[model samples]
Target: MSTPSRFKKDKEIIAEYESQVKEIRAQLVEQQKCLEQQTEMRVQLLQDLQDFFRKKSEIEMEYSRNLEKLAERFMAKTRSTKDHQQYKKDQNLLSPVNCWYLLLNQVRRESKDHATLSEIYLNNVIMRFMQISEDSTRMFKKSKEISFQLHEDLMKVLNELYTVMKTYHMYHAESISAESKLKEAEKQEEKQIGRSGDPVFHIRLEERHQRRSSVKKIEKMKEKRQAKYSENKLKSIKARNEYLLTLEATNASVFKYYIHDLSDLIDCCDLGYHASLNRALRTYLSAEYNLETSRHEGLDIIENAVDSLEPRSDKQRFMEMYPTAFCPPMKFEFQSHMGDEVCQVTAQQTVQAELMLRYQQLQSRLATLKIENEEVKKTTEATLQTIQDMVTIEDYDVSECFQHSRSTESVKSTVSETYLSKPSIAKRRANQQETEQFYFMKFREYLEGSNLITKLQAKHDLLQRTLGEGHRAEYMTTRPPNLPPKPQKHRKPRPRSQCSAKLFNGDLESFIKDSGQVIPLIVESCIRFINLYGLQHQGIFRVSGSQVEVNDIKNSFERGENPLADDQSNHDINSVAGVLKLYFRGLENPVFPKERFNDLISCIRIDNLYERALHIRKLLLTLPRSVLIVMRYLFAFLNHLSQYSDENMMDPYNLAICFGPTLMPVPDIQDQVSCQAHVNEIIKTIIIHHEAIFPDVKELDGPVYEKCMAGDDYCDSPYSEHGTLEEVDQDASTEPHTSEDV
Candidate 1:
C-alpha cells in the first residue's frame, strides 16, 4: 500500500506483461520463417518437375527415332520378292512408321476365311503381321527401361509438389494465428501501460483534492492510448493480410507449373506407349481397356488440378472483394452500362481512333495537293514560254511574215557572203545558168518520156473548172484544151476496219486498213524520222510511234495476210494516201477550205513559181496542229522512202503521183498534160521539202494551233487572238501590231 511497495508491484506486473508480448512476437517470427521455407521448397519442386518433363520429352524423341530406324531396316529385309518396280510399289504394305496409321486401315478388308486357306497362305499372313516382331520387341524393351526411369522421376516430382504445397498452407494458417495473438498481446500491453500512468499524461490517483480531474485525465489518456493501439493493430492486420495474399498467389503459380509439367509427362508417356510399347499394334487394334483407363485417369487428374488451381469466387463476391481489379468493359458493353465513367473513356478512345484516321487522310490529301500544285506551276511556265515565242514570230512585217526574220536573214546573208560574194556572184550566176539549162533539158526529156505533159495541161484546166462557178470562167484561159485525159483506174475502197484510232476520218481509216503492210511500214519509217529530227515537237511526237507501228503490224499480221496481194507494190502508195487524209482530217483548218476552195486554186496559176510557192506555203501553214506534225514526219517519210524505190515499192514521185489528186480534189482533166503538170508540181514541192512550207517556230510551238484552232470562238477572233492565220491581206492593210503592242 505504500509508495515503494505499489511501485514495485506495478513494475513486476509490467515485466510479466512484457514477457507475454515478447513470446507472442517470437511465435510470429517463427511462423514467418516457416512460411518462407515452404515458399522456397515449393519453388524448387516446380523447377525440378519442369526439368524432369523436358528430359522425358527428349528421351521419348530418341526412343521413337530408334524405333523408326528399326522399322525401316525390317521393311527393307521383308520387301516383296517381285520385279523391282512392283517390289518398290508394294514395300509400303506394312511399313511400321507412325504416320502410316492411316495406311493400316487397308487391313480391315483382309480375308477372315483363314480356315479355308492352304497352310502356306496362312503362314504368309502370319509373317506379314509379325515380320518386324523381333526388332520391335528389342526396341520396346529399351523404351520400357526409359519409361520406367521417367515414371519414377515424374512420381517423385508430383509427391514433392504435393508435400510442399501442404506444408505451405499449414504454415500460412499458423502465421495468421500468430499474427492475431501478437495483436492481442499488444492490446494487453497498452492496457497495462494505461494503468501504470506514463509521464506524458501525468495523471495520479493519489491526489485526493484533484481526484475527479485526475480521473477524467486518466480516462482521457486511457482512451487515447486505446485508439492509438487499435490503429497499430489495424496496420498489423493489413500487413498479415498482404502476406497471406502473396503466399496464396505463390501457391497458385506453383500449382499451374506443376499441372503443366505433369500434363507434358503424361503426353510423353502416351507417345512412348504408342511408339515403343510391347505389342503396340495389337494393343491399339484391340482398344485395350487397361491402357485407356490409365490415360483417362491422367486426363481426369489434369482437369481436377486445373479446377482446384482456379481461384474460386462468385461474380458478386469478386466484385465486393476486388471491385477495381477487373479489366474495363468494352466500348459496346459501356452502352448497356450507360451513365458510367467507362462510357466516357470508350468515347475518348473512339474519338482518338477517328482523329488518327482523319489525320492520315489529311496527310495524303496534302501530298496530292503538293503534286497538283507542281504540275500547275510547270504548265503555267510552258504556257508563258509559248506566248512569248508567238509574240516574237508575230513581230515580223506582214509582207514577209512567212519569210525568216532579220535574225535568220542575217544568218542567210552571212552564209551567202561566205560562198557567193559580190565578186564571185557573176561567175556563180553563169555556172547556175548552164546548170539550169541542163536541168531544163533533163526535165523536158523526162516529161516527154513519161508522156505526162498533156496530162499536166488537162489537170490545170480541170482544177480551174472545179474552182467555183464565178471563178471557173476567169481562170480557164491558160489551160491547153486539145489534150484528152486517160480513163481513171481506181480500186473500190474497202470498208474501214474498226480501229482504236477514233480521231481518224473514215477516208483515213479505210486507206490505212486497205494499205495493210504498207501503212505499218510507213509508220515505222515516220517514227524513226521524228525520233531523229522532230525530237523537240510535242503532241503525237511524244508517242512511241515506231514501237506502236511495229506492235500494230505484228497484231494485224497475226490476224490475217495482207489483202493487197494483187497490188503489193501499190500498198505503200495507198499508205501515203491514207496518211495525207489523216493529216487533213486532224487539222482544225482544212487544207482545201470549203469556203476558200477557189482562192487557194488561184495561187497555183501565179506567174512566179517562188511567189506561187510562197502563197501555197502560206495556205498550208494556215492549217493548225495536225498539218504541222504531218508535214514534218511526212517530209522525212517520203525522203526516207525515195531512197528505197529501186525495189519498185514507192518513191517520192510515186507518192506525189498517187496523193496529188486525192489531196487537191480537182475535177476530171480534159488535158493529160495539165493534169500531170499540176500533180507533179504539188508532189515535188510539198511532200519533199515540207519544212519550207511550215518554217516558223510559232508554227511548231503547240499553243498556237491548240488555242486558235480548237477554240469554239475561232471565226470571230483574229489570227493573233485565235491562232488561225485568217485574212493576211486585211492584216497587211492595217498597221501591224509590233511585239510591244501584243
Candidate 2:
C-alpha cells in the first residue's frame, strides 16, 4: 500500500512543486522596484573618470600655453638686448648672491617700496631657460660650423645638377632631330606574296591601296606620339624651373637675420663700446633675477611684433633683405693741408736740431777715442814686452828651482792656461777622422761668423791665482795676521755639459729646416733674426726689422746679469748655443768658449760662412720631426728679451708660418712684405681651385693666405707698426729689391 500510494503521491507532489516554483520566481522577480541607487552609483564612477580626464587635459593645455608664452617672451628679451647698453661687459655673468642682499638693504633704507619680483611663471621659466639657453648655444656652435660646410656643399650640388640637366636637354634635342630624319628614310613598298612554309593569299587592287593607307596612318600615329612626348617634356621642364625657384627661396629663408640697433642714448661709438654693453647687460640679468618680478616688458614686445607682422607674399625677397638699420654713421672731418704741413715742419726742426748736436758731439768723441785707443795699443804692446821678458827670467829661475820645487809643493803652469796641446797620436785616434773635418769646418765657421763667448779665464782667474804657487807668497807678503780665508769659486761638472749638450746638439741643425733641402733666403733671414734677438750677450741688438746694432749688445753684456747660479750658466750656455746655431747653422761655434772666440777673432776666413750654412741645410733636411720641436725654442726666446729704450719689445716685426708643402724661392731680393703678399696670393689660388683636385686637406691652404692677418701682438714687435719704418731699412737700398719701408 505504501509503494503504490507513494508513487501516485510523488507524481502529484512533483507537478504541484513545479507550479509553485514558477509562481514563486515570478512573484520574486516582479517585486524589485528601486532604480535610483544603481543609477546613482554607476553615474558617480563614470563622473569620477570623466572629471579626472578633464582635469588632466586642462593641466596639459595650461602648461603648453605657458611654455609658448615663455618662448615668445624669451625671443623678445633677446631682441631687445641686441640694442641695450650692457650687452658685452663679461665680468661675472651672475652677481654674488650677497650682492642682491646688499642692494636690497640700500634700497630699503632709501625708500619704503619693496624690491619688485617677477611673476612665478615667468621667473621659473627664465631660470630654467638660462641654463638651457647657454647649453643650446654652445651645442649649436658645432652645428653652426657644420652648417657652413653643408651650405657650401648644397651650392656645389645645385650647380652640378643644373649643368648636367642642361647637357642632357641639349643631347635630347639633337637625338630627336636625328630621329626625325630617320623617319623620312623609312618608307613602305608593295611586293608579290607567295606561299612558302605557310598559306598565302594575294589582295585585290583595292586591298593593296588599303595596306598603303594603313602604313600612312601608322606614320601619322608615330608623329603624334613624338609630339606628345615633346609636350610632356615641356611640362617637366616648367615644373623643374618652378622647383628651382622654390629651392632658391627656401635656401634664402633657412637663416634668420637679427637686427640690433645701438642704444638710444649712445652717440656714434666703436665696436668696443657695443661689445662692452652686451657683456654688461648679460651680467645684470644674471644678477637681477627675482622670483616674483613681472615680465610685462618682454610680453609687450612679443605682443607688438605679433600684432604688427603681415603674412609675407614674397618670401624670397623678404629673406634677402639684410639688417641694415642698426649702427649709425659717425661724422669726422679731415685735417686741413696747412695744418698737416705745420706739424711736419715743427717735427723736422726738432729732429734736425737734435741730430746736428749729436753729430758734433759724436765727432768730438770719435777724435778723443782715436787718441785714447792709440795710447791703449801702445801701452798694451809695452805691457806684452814686459810680460815676455818677465816670463823668460821667471822661467830661468823656475827651471833652476824646479829641481828643488819638484820635491816641494809650488809648481806654477801659466803657459798651460793659454796654450792648447798639439794633436798627439792618442788624441787623434780617440775620435773618428771624420769628426776632425767636422770640427775644422765648425772652427772655420767661428772664424767667419761673430758669436759671443763666455771666457772661462774671466770667470776663474782669481781662483786660479789664489790657489796657485804665487798665492801663498802673495798672502804672506800682504796678510794682516788673523784674517779668515774668503770663499772660493766651487766648480760643478755635470751631465748637462755632456748629456744635454749631446741631446741638444744632435737636433740643432734640423730644427731650422724648411720645406726642402735648400732653405730659402727669407728663411735664412728669419733664422738670423731669431739668432740676433735671442743672443743678447753677443754684440748685437734687435733694432727693428731684421737689423741689429753691435754696440747695444756690448753695453748689455758689460752690464752683466747678477752673479749667476750654476743652473743659470747652463741655461745661458744652451741659449747661446741654440740661438747661434739658428743664425750660423752650427751649434758648437756659436756657443764657443771665450778662448775659441779669441782664436777666431785673431784670424780671418770669410769663405767658410757659406759652406757652414750649406752644410747645415743638409744636416736639417735629414730629419724633419725634430724641426718643430726645436722651433718652440724661438717662442721661448721671444718671451725672455727686454724692451729697448727706443723699442716696445724685442722680437720679430712679422712672420709667415708655412704648414703645407712650403712654397719657396721667389727670385730676387723681395723683402718680407712682398714675400708675404706672394705667399698669400698663392694660398688664395689654391683655395679657389677645384676641391676635387686638392681634397679636404686644403685647410693647409690657410696659413699662407692668413699670414697677412697676423699682427704685431702675435710677433712681439719692438715698435709701433704704424707709419714708422726701421732705420735699417736703409740697408735694403743697396739690396735693390728691398722696399723702402722694410
Candidate 3:
C-alpha cells in the first residue's frame, strides 16, 4: 500500500473511463449512419413516385388523344365496296376500340338506353384520363410530404445527438482532471517516503493515501456512469420523437390520399354520367347519310302517283294528302298595260307643271327688280341731298382783283417795291405800324360810339357805393347762392399719341383702312371667316386647307391677280387663324416670347390695373413692328367677333384660349393644352382692356415688308432686324409662291 500502488490505481481508472466514452461515441456514429440511410431511402422512394406520376399522366394524355383520333377516323371512312379490307386493318388499334366498346356498354347501363354510343365513348375516355392524372399527382405529392416530415424528424435527432456528444466531452474532461490530481498526490507521497517499510508513520500515511485514492477512483467511476446514463436518455428521447413524427405523418398522408381518391372518383362518375348516351347518338348519325336521299325519292313517287288520278274527287283527296307539294295555277290580269300608260302620263304632266312654275317665278323676280330700280334712284337722290347739308361749299369772286392789276416799267416797279430802304429804326417803330394803328383806331371809335364813358362812370359810382360799406353787399353780389358748378373732364395722359382716334376704338375695319397697306384678299377673307364662324365655335372650327389659302393669297398679291375674286370658298376660319399665326411667328421677334410668358403672367397679378396694362404694353412694344401691326389688327378683329348674343357670343376669355397656344411659343402641344387656361386669363386681361393696357401703342401704318425695306429704326426688335424680313419679302415677291408661303 505504497505511493506507487495508488498512482497505478489512478491510471487504471482513467483508462477505463476513456474506453467507456469511446464506446458511447461509436454507438452514436452507428445511429447517425442508420438515420442517413433511412433518409436516402425515403428520398429515392419519393423521386420514384414523382417519375411514375409524370409517366402515367403522359400515357393517359396520349391515350385520350389517340381515342379521339380513332373515333374521328372511323366515322370519316367511306364504307364502299373497296374499303372492307381497310376497315379490318384498322382493328389493329385495339386499345382505343376496346375502350370505346367498354364506354358504350357503360353508358347503355347507366343511361337506360337514352344516350349515343360514340359520344359516350369519347367523354368517358377523356374523363378517365383526367381522373387518373389527378390521382397520380395527389399520390406523388403525399409521398413527397411524408419524406419531408421524415427529414425534419431526422434533423431534430441529429441536433439532440450533437448536444449529447458535447455533454459527454465536458464530463470526460472533468474526470481526467480528477485522475491527474490523484496521480500527483501519490507521486508527492512517494518522493517523501520511498521504502515500504521505512516507518510506521510513513506506512500509515501511505495506507491513508491509498484509501483516499480508492474512494476518489470509485467516485469518478460513479460520475462517468451517470454521464453515460444521461447520454443514453437523450438518444432515447430523440428516437421516440422521430417515431412519433413518422407515425403522425403516415396517418395524415393515408387519410388525405384516400379521401381525395374517393372524392375524385365520385366527381368523375357524376360529371361523365351522359358519356355513353352521347356516344350512341354519334354512332347512329355516322351511319345515317342515305336517309335524306331516301326521303326525296319517296316524295317524288307520291307526286307521280297523284298525277295519275282522273276523277275530281280522287284529285281533291290526293291534294289534301300532300297539301304543301303542289303549285297553284297563275291567273293573268288585263289592267297591267292601262296601269303602265297612266304612270307615264302622270310623270310627264308633273315635269310640265314644274317647268311652268319655274317660268312664273322668274317673271315675278324680273318685276321685283324693276321696282328695286325705282327705289334705288330715290335713295341716290336722298344721299346726295344729305351730303350737301353735312358739308358746305362757299363761292368766292376774285374778278375785281384781277381787273385792277396795272402794268409798270421795271425801274418803277423796283423803286416802289424797295421803298422800305428809306426807313429808320425810330420811324419804323413810330409811323403807324399797320396792324397796331388799325386795331387802336377801331377800339377808340367803338368806345366813343357805344356810351363807354357813361358806363365807366356808372361802374365807378357803384364800386364806391359798394366799398363804403362793410363789404356784405359785395359778397352777396360776387358769390351768387343759386348758381351750379360746372363739371370738369378728367383726362388720362397718353404716353404716345402719334396717330390715334378721340374715342376708345375697337373697330378693326377702321384699323385696316387707316393702315393704308394692301392686305391680301385671302387675308381679309380669312378674317371674315374667323369672325363669322370662329366666334361661334371657339376652338371647334379651324381654317380648313391653310396651305392652299396661303398659296393662293401669295399668288394673287405677287402676280397681280384680281384681289376681289368672287369665289371666297378658298378661305376658311382655320386658314385665317393659320395666317395670323404665321404673321406673328414670321416676325423678327415672337410677340409672346417664350422666356417672358411667365414674367407676363406674374405682371398680370399686379394690383394696379394700369400698371399691369403698362407692363403688358411694354412687353408688346418689345415685339417687331410687323408683329405689333398684326397684333393691333388681331385685337380689333377679336373685339368685333365678340359682339354677339348667347351661344355665338365669344368673350375675350374664349378668344384668348382659342389663340394663346397658336400665338405663344410652347415646348409642345401637350404643354400648350395644359397651360391654355392660364394663357386665356392673361390674354383676356391684355386684349379686352387693350386701350387702357396699351394706351400709347399704335398699329403700323404700312406693309411690314416695306418698312423693313426702308430701314425704319422702329422695326428693330429684341430678336434683331438685319434685313431678314426684307429678304423674305423679296423672295416671296419674286418667286411664284402660293398663299401657303405667307
Best by TM-score: 3
Cα lDDT tens digits for candidate 1, 1-742? 4446644654564455346435433433443343234334434544453344445435534553454455455445544434324545654443444234322221111111111121112222222223223323332333344334433443443344334433433443344445455566566656655654645345545553354455566556556656655555444333332232233333333333222322222222222122211222222212222212456655565444433321112222322333222212111111110111221111133243443343344334444554554555465445434423321221111111112332301112011122224565356445534443343333323322222222222223332332335544443342233211211111222223533322222233333345432233333433333323332232221122333333333234223333333322322332323333344434333334445445455665775545665777777666544434545545545544443344433444555555455455544332332444464556545554444565655546521112122224323322123111233223322522111100
In angstroms, the error of model 3 at 678 is 3.0
Worst 10 residues of 3 by lDDT: 408-417
* Tens-place lDDT digits, model 3, residues 2-83: 4566456545644554464354344434433433343354345445544554454455445545555554454445233234
* Candidates in order: C-alpha RMSD to true structure: 47.6, 45.4, 56.9
lDDT of each: 0.36, 0.30, 0.39
Q: What is the TM-score of each candidate against the true structure?
A: 0.20, 0.19, 0.23
Of 1 and 3, the candidate ahead on TM-score is: 3
Give the candidate order by descending TM-score: 3, 1, 2
- Over 1-742, each residue of candidate 2 has an lDDT whose tens digit, in order, gives 2446644654564455346434433322221111122223334543453444345435544654454455445444643552322434542334543364334333332121111112111222233223223322332333233333433433443344344334433443444444454454343211221112233266577866666676666567667656655654444333333233322322222211111111100111111122222222232232222211376466456444433322121111222332122212111111111111211111133233443343344334444554554555465445434422321221111111112222212223122111123464235324323342343333323311211111111112222232445443543454332222221111112222222222112223332232121222223323334334333432222122111222222122222221222222222323333223333332332222223322222222223323322332333333333332233223223323322212432222211122111222232233332244444322222221112112122322111111112223324444223221122223222322211111
Better of 2 and 3 by TM-score: 3
* Ten-residue region with minimum lDDT total, candidate 1: 330-339
| C-alpha lDDT (0 to 100) for residue 180 of candidate 2 | 56
- Which residue runs of candidate 2 sit more than 4 Å off their true CA positions? 1-200, 234-253, 256-742
Deviation in Å, model 2, residue 225 alpha carbon: 2.7
